[model samples]
Target: MTKADFVRRCRWLIACAVLFASANAWADEKSELKEKALKLNSITGKDPIDGKIKELAKDAENTKKMLKVAAEVAKEKPQPFQYNGAFILARAARELKENEIALEFFNISTQLAMKVKSASKLLESFDGKISLLYEQKKFDEAEKACQELLDLEIDPKFEEAKIIVLEQMIQFKAKQGKIEEALKLTDNLMKLDEGGWYFVRLKGWVLHEAGKYKESAETYLDTIKKLSENKRLKEEEKERWIERTRYILSSVYVDMGQIDQAAEQLQMLLKKKPDHPTYNNDLGYIWADRNMNLDESEKLIRKALEEDRKQRKKEGVEKDKDNAAYLDSLGWVLFKKKQYAEAKKYLLDAVKDEDGQHIEILDHLADVHMALGEKKEAIAVWKKALDTEPASKRDLKRLEEVQKKLKAAEGK
Candidate 1:
């Protein structure tokens, strides 16, 4: 061979040797990572919370390594371990806010769990996948996942999970403007539940969400009537059901612009359980929102805050922070009463609380800022309200209103 040909042959051999060495190094690393993952025993056990997975998720480098090994194991391992690896990867991905990866692995976990015929693992995987899909507003995929969950070979012990899935499916359909389909799902749920009153109440909720206020109110009344006649339910349970339905009926009345009817339902509930925080807050907020009974609304709101604090103490919550919703009620009532300064104070605190970090509450705060002539603050708050994730159809509507408000304020 010529000298140049000999040199070319040697270079080709050297290139092949380097590639082979690099492949070996990757194999070694993959083996080490797989071993480390399998050693996270808690992930594959009855308790799936693994300190190692959580610890690994806390660091970017470790998270990358964990995901790499987990993907390989999920793809190549056998049934149970495959599910375990996928589940671990999903959990870690969720922790790191890698939602798309989490959704993918959760789906893989669900498929593997089905192969292993593990009901609990399947449910967990489905839950993770469905919630991620829902949060991402991938409604079509969420609808499909919900149906798949209902089609699972659900264990008797997991019947409640099935019911919960049905409820989510109904809500999904309702939000998509598929009112008839949503009602049909509710009917199916009622059949599965043997015509339980709660299902009837759920039907009422579906109707209410679909803007069928009259039908919704009637269904709620039907639910209450059924509750009263059910000999199987204890008196206290029946009463509780009736009270909740009444509260729900009140909202239906409010939607129909039947303020008097709404107030009557709440009044009935308050007569029986005077200190019920929710009842007080709802009635007070409704009256305040309508700019009627401002004095009485403020009183009821204050009572709600007080009663809510007492209830939290009774429940042994370590922190005794005031309920954010109740605080919003108070702030809104004060705003209606033209006490903008005090209203802003309560609203600022309300917005700081986790539960109060809602578009509606933010709008209320923004309104207060506008009332107090803080135009810049109001615009900022309205922008923030728009930025907050809308959790429901109502929030979406509120966001539209906020957009309008921002446009008007900016124009001014």
Candidate 2:
């Protein structure tokens, strides 16, 4: 070869050798990582693997190292070990709010479970995947996951898992406004266990979401009747279910603009659990919003706040924070009574609470501001309300009303 060609060949060989050495080094490092993770899993003392993960994951650098080792172990380990390790990692990561990593491990666990034909593990993994997707509002992906689980030829021993998956599918369809599809899924759910009273209640919920108020009310009544006659349920359980269904039926009546029918349900519940914070607050808010029973509404709302404080204390909560929704109810009642200054105080405090950053609460506060002749403040509050995202169709309609209010105030 010529000298220039020989020199170029030598340089190319040197480059290839360096690349080979680097690749080997990386492979050795990866093997060591997998070895370390497998060793960690085998170390047994009061869940040493879990403890190590929790400790190591506290720091960002350590977390990355831990996740790398975990991923390698999950992907390369043998059956049972692979599934268990991946599941543990996914659970820990989810608790730590490392959602993307959690999702990856969950998918790995699911694949391993399917390969091993472990029906229980498959169900658990799918549950995790579906829950995370739902929380992230990835509804399309969640529905697909639910449908995949439903299509699985799972053992009859795991029929309960199938029922749960079917229930979730119904909810998913209902949320998407596919009322007929949701209703059909509910029928399939009911077929899994004919005596499942809860499934009947689920149908009531679907009907309510579909705006079939009369049918929803009828379904809830049937559920309540079934609960009353159910020999299987404990008395306490029966009462709780009946109370809840009655409360739901009240909401249906409210939506149908049958205020008297709604009041009857709340009164029945209050007679049984007079100090229930939610029952008191809901009935009070309904009355106050309609400018009916103002005095009774004020009393009920005050009682709600009192009971809520007591309940929080009993639960051993460190902070005795007032519920923002209850605060809004009280403030609205006061505003209805022309106590604008007092209403503003409670509404301001309501808006300060973490759960109080809602369009409805802001709308109430803006109205109070307007009543107090704080026109600029009202305008500012309304603009903030406009910026807030709506959570429901009702909220969207309320937003339109708020927009019109803003325009009128601005024009004035």
* Number of the top TM-score candidate: 2
lDDT tens per residue, model 1, 351-393: 9887888999999999999998999999999988887899766
Which portions of model 2 miss their true places by more than 4 Å? 1-128, 153-155, 188-196
Off by over 4 Å in 1: 1-40, 43-98, 153-167, 185-198, 271-273, 311-321
Model 2: colliding residue pairs: none
Question: Each candidate: what lDDT?
Answer: 0.84, 0.85
Q: Which ten residues in a row have the lowest lDDT in candidate 2?
A: 72-81
Model 1: pairs clashing at backbone N, Cα or C within 3 Å: none
Cα lDDT tens digits, model 2, 1-412, are 9999999999999999999999999888777756655554354444775676566556556556667666655554353256666776676677676788889888887887888878888987888888887777677778888888777775775665677787887887887788999998787777876876898899999999888989999999888988888999999988988988999999999988898899999999999999999999999999999999999999999999999999898998765789999999999999999999999999999999878999999999999999999999999999999998787667888999999999999995
The TM-scores, one per candidate, come to 0.74, 0.76
